[model samples]
Target chain A: MLTLQKPHRHVETVIHSEVLIDCRIENLYYGDFRAIRDCDLSIERGKITAFIGPSGCGKSTVLRCMNRMNDLVQGFRIDGQIHFQGQDIYHPSVDPVAVRRHIGMVFQQPNPFAMSIYKNVAFGLKLNRVKDDIPGRVEDALRRAGLWDEVKDKLKSSALALSGGQQQRLCIARAIATEPQVLLMDEPCSALDPIATRRIEELMLQLKERYTIVIVTHNLHQAQRIADKTAFMYVDTSNSSRTGFLVEYADTHRLFNHPQQEYTLQYLRGEFS
Target chain B: MPTPAQSPHVSQSNSMVSNHSKRSPARTSPTFEVSVVSPPSTTDVLVDRGFRGLAYVFAWLTIVLVCTILYEIGGHAFPAIQEYGLSFVTQSTWDANNAQFSVLPEIWGTLSSSLLALAIATFFGVFIAIFLTQDFLTPRVERVFTTIFELLAAIPSVVYGLWGIYIVIPTIRPIATWLHEHLGTIPFFSTPLSGPGLLPASLVLSIMILPTIAAVSRDAISAVPNQLREAAYGLGATRWQVIPGVVLRTASSGIFGAMVLGLGRALGETMALAMLIGNSNQVSLSLFSPANTLAALLANNFPEAGKVEEQALMFAALILLAITLGVNMIGTVIIDRTTRRLTGGTS
Candidate 1:
């Protein structure tokens, strides 16, 4: 039987090379409202993991926990462990800024800073104190994000002049400029058109070769098309208090075709989405 | 062709025309308009016209008041300006006994003192705004502190003058003396502090303008979008880095506006400066030397002046107004240019 049980400490350490992130969330709360119940998930290295759920299911909450972005919220508390490369990210000694330096995030809306495209990409490099070969690194990041060809001619022009799809690509380039290992994308294509969406999905597929990508999306077709593994989360209202929990997680084809849990089946069948 | 209502074809065409007019108001002629029953009553028309007339008058009051003030001041200042010609603003002599008055010394005093006040106010005000708006204090504590700072502006100018004389002068005397003894080679700090002078007056002016700068700056900093701060943090920027790199950059134009407002207040301030500044009609480089701004001179000698002296004071007032207006205009232009650049505008 293939059981998704918690691995022991030594066993996890032994299998650490296979997994890039291990999220074991016991409970998460915002103020007095419980947001997420006990959940355990493992993200494979160099693969795309998609978190798919309805609104208010706390899928983005779990994604934010991976990079400790939830720490910015007031009265946000978590009682769990998210281990990145065999180290607990929430440990007292871990600096959030240092953690963020290694993990980058792309937001739902393409928020290019109110500056030039080159400066947007160089912001992270400068913050990390990358003094030497900054121009080369910025060009390299833009090329990898598939934006260099479009923006190379106007590197000094304001980023606000770019089209919506180009701006999203610029944000992606900005995030990866510092060479972060993991990229968390929260609906990166939600604000994009169909063509832009396809382009970004293709870019993500190519990016997974070098970076571990975790994405939260409401579009199930997008997950089925690009994700290697898919995790389904549902609002668990069995105990009177509503909180989200992991329902089923498996390889993309199996999760969509043969969901094991009744909730997953209902969600897939458009009965209780 | 047809007996009006007897012919079916003629009646049908007439009905069609009525239906078309009903469907489209734009197709109806002005003389054939529908009156929708009763018109407005006589009392309503009267009241409407009356209200509009009042609003028009109120709107024109500002222009009328400003023109009146300019005319009166110009008329009084004409004699002095004609007598001195261009030398009225260039030469630095104010012998009222000989009816010789030049605005050079007062112009230097006003510019130097007001500029110094603005510099000091901007330095402390920006820091105070940063402290108040950031996460260093709780919201409740921040409100209390902000209210206290606002209260500083409510204190009258004469009260500030009294405080400067009794408390501030004695307190800063020792520090001024020490600075003069140590940094004496610097011309600004060379003179020894003996009594009320330019330094005390400027200190008092800075204090008076502090609340204006602080309040406006606090509002500007608070107006910065939280998303910019979050974006900076996501890029692994520390709090200190985010402040200068994001918050200050975004709020720079508004902060400049706040400083200009403080400068305006500093230039026009009268009672406190009249009492604190040793009203001597001379220009000196040392901060400890006695000086007189145009405002202080007018306040000191306006009541007991002869006809020519009065005209001279009026001329000084006109100069003060011109300088303040020029500063405001230049400051606004600079701020506008900076904002345009920040927003990626070509001009």
Candidate 2:
């Protein structure tokens, strides 16, 4: 019953959007269902773009669409254009395996592979054949994710032994080890406590200078504190049946404070169910 | 806390209402109050009645059967036991006219052929199991292959012996000839393959035991948890890495148990060795030459042996039983140690 439709047409400049990821749009499908309809979005480089919405709003679906992670899901199909660094990701000549090597991902749950702590971070590097000086690279990734000192001595221990917070950091370390140009995190801190969430937020702030980050988060406050750009989505339940839509995307302060849409205002006021 | 009194009048009135309902007539309505009776306790019933006494009867029946066999064979061999005085096992030369027989050659032939069979079965059977369990084939193709192999296990030993004599010999003769010419310098194949011998016997026995090793090893490999495979894949480990590093290491102990079971079966095989081993009592290391296995020797010559020869045959039977039972005991120990190691690490 919450619609993110703007009351009237408005134009807001997306700074440096033409130079960043030039994403083209078409409908995306999950079998017979039209999950994302005519979605056209461009992400500015080196800035945090948070996809914010209630449950089943297709925000995460679009986020997965960005990295083509939906290929792992059975019967998932996309009819759209997603470009990374001016390359068509879905082109016939392009290999999804190679695409993943360049665009790294962190999943919703902290899924560090069942391996030694060092090997978990070194997995992508090894796959890409970045052979020499593996230990130093793994240590550097851990340090960047703020997990070095606690896990330095336990490099050979099972990654599953780490706490949930540490495991999430380890996943982040693993994603960055590939030296990817873009990082897509689908709800990175939803499983963590507030303190842990704050640590991840700080890590993200530090990482934005190096990697373009796209995060899908349900926490409005966390998004406000961390995101440079925000995309708000909601269900068009006027028929009490139709799925959802992403109605507005703008700079963080504008999206949270002064919106042109009634639904956006109600959502910001926590009045919409 | 103090108990509050409802006064005697209220208590009496409340009790009267309940009693009135309790006294309602059963003639106009169905009976709602039925008592439940608990079943008799198992222990009490068992204690009241003694065991069926069939167990005691069966136990005594087994003992009597064993005693009957011992009595029959013992009575038959008693004269030889008195005459030979334990020399029947040590002396190898058999002279029917003089009634002098020795079993040393038969014992040597039995051990070498069975051991050679075991070595071949262990090598090839384990290799086959690993190949089938890996992702070398599509799932449907793998299923067909597995079913065919499983059927191989069900083939009777006599049929295997017949096939070995009729089919396998002609097929493998070229390889045997090649080995005789090329690897004949080796002690095991130094002699020419004039006819069936220790090599043929071992090859036949290996074929008989191959199915067992493959089936058991396949079961053990399939029993490895799917989570382990997924975890390895998630680390971007290739098929080879996952198989050797995770799957095989996890299933190694179980495969070893399977191999030992196959070895035990190989040591006791009789008809196949009898048909293929040429039944010659010699201890030559050359595999191309004729030899005899303990089971084959007993099966072929026991019925014709006189009192002295028969007692020596009984000694060979006892030795074969001891070897098999010893192998089973060691297998139990190894399997126990391996299972303990696995459970200790995982749990």
Candidate 3:
């Protein structure tokens, strides 16, 4: 049995080499409230995973934990392991800025900096020391997000001029322009109309073929449409403490059609009422 | 209504008289009211016409203010101009006994001291502003420093002059001595001090203007949007890059306006200059030498002036006014241009 464990360890090494994000947590806190309690999640390489939950269920919190964007908030902290690719992300040796370069994020609101559309996409590239041929790179990013045909001639126009759905796509294009291995989206389509939302959902499907995608969403239909794997979360109000728990995580079809837990069944049957 | 000017048909007196004196008082009154209600309506015209009258008065008052200032300065300086002509600007002679009052020395002294003060104030003031705005200090500490600087500004200029006389002059003497010994090799610091000179005056002026620049600059820098800072940091730029590229660039126009305003104040300072600058009459560019500004010279000699000399002093006052007005005008223009550019509009 000890010899059998040795070969399993080597196979595990091969499996981890293919993983893009490895998250381990003892607890995550936002001012003494444990948002995600002792949760461990690994985002697979080149696959789309959807985190589905009710409001305030720590889905977005876990997504922010991946990129360390939580560091920007006051009194937000996590105790545990979060490795990007293979390196310990929270270690003193790693700079948060450098970690963020490898792990890109798209926020719920489409925040393009107050500049020209082209400049907005090129902002990250300049900071990451890619100075040559910015126009070409910007066009390429826009094309990948399928926005180039609409905005190619008007590159110098203000980003605020774009529609909500187009702006969200622009944000996605901006994030991928830096060529990050992992992309984290927090309800990327919550503010978009159906057509724009459909476009983003399609874009996510295409993007996963090249990069790992982890999305936090409240819409179950959206998860069904785009996610390969699904994580269902619920707020645990049992101890008079506001916290969230991962109720179930499995292949999307099974989680939806053949859920095991009573709570999962009741939730999927819309029987929370 | 009656024909134009033919009013007897609807006149109340006519109706009352027609009713006759034998009628009862109530009956006559009703008849009179009915007659007046229908009378020709041509009596509602009254005019004070005061606005048109006041407009001329205000226009004349404005003209008078402008002309009086020009006349007072011109009338006093006319004789000096006649006697010394343009030589007053070119030559440095200031023999009060001989009555040869050329202004080259005083002009040079004023420009050098004021410029030096502006330079020193701008450096320290902007540094303090950036420090204050960037959260370098705690809120309580920031408030204390801000209050202290503002209080320094509110202290009367006369108090600053007195402080210069008793405290600052004596305290800085040793530093001045060291500078003279060490930096005397440099042409700027070559001259030796005799009691008080341009250096002491410039130091006092710097202290006076420092609060002005700092307060205004702090306001300007604080106006930069937090979004700009976040954008820079989000791109992996450090705190240093955010300040220079985002905060400072956004606030540049406002900061420039603040500095120019401080410059105008420095140029026009009076009491401190009168107190500390040795008031010598020479056009020496040397910082260590005694010198006089137009204001200081006017303060010093106006009381003792004869008719012609008084005129000369007024001309000097006029010159001082012109310099200040010019500086302020230029500052206003630059501020206008900067704000327009920042807001993305034509000024």
Residue pairs of candidate 3 with colliding backbone atoms: B76-B311, B77-B311, B105-B282, B105-B283
Q: lDDT tens digits, residues A26-108, model 3?
A: 78888787887756767887778899877887888888888777776657888898877577888877677776676778878
Docking class of 1: incorrect
The per-residue C-alpha lDDT of model 1 at residue B32 equals: 62
Interface quality of candidate 2 as DockQ = 0.05
Scored against the true structure, residue B327 in model 1 reaches a CA lDDT of: 93
- True lDDT of residue B49, candidate 2: 60
Per-residue error (Å), model 2, residue B297: 5.6
| lDDT ranking, high to low | 1, 3, 2
Between candidates 1 and 2, name the one with more favorable lDDT. Answer: 1
The true-versus-predicted C-alpha distance at residue B290 of model 3, in Å, is 3.4
What is the C-alpha lDDT profile of model 2 across B1-347, one tens digit per residue? Answer: 11122233356668889997888776656654565577899986886565656677888999999788767656665666667656766766667668776667777877787778878987887777878877677678888988888887788888988888887777767877899899988987788776677887788888788888888988888887764554344444556666766677668788888878888888888888888888776678888888777788789877788766777666666667667778889888887776655443333
Worst 10 residues of 1 chain B by lDDT: B1-10
Candidate 3 per-residue lDDT, tens place, B49-130, comes to: 5666788899999999989988977876788878888888888777767787788877787778888998999889988899
Candidate 2 wrong stretches, greater than 4 Å:
A1-78, A89-92, A95-97, A103-131, A141-273, B1-145, B187-189, B194-274, B277-346
| Pairs in clash, predicted candidate 1 | none
Chain A TM-score per model, please list them: 0.92, 0.90, 0.91
Candidate 3 stretches greater than 4 Å from native? A1-18, A24-40, A47-64, A72-74, A105-178, A183-273, B1-111, B138-141, B162-186, B193-195, B303-310, B336-347
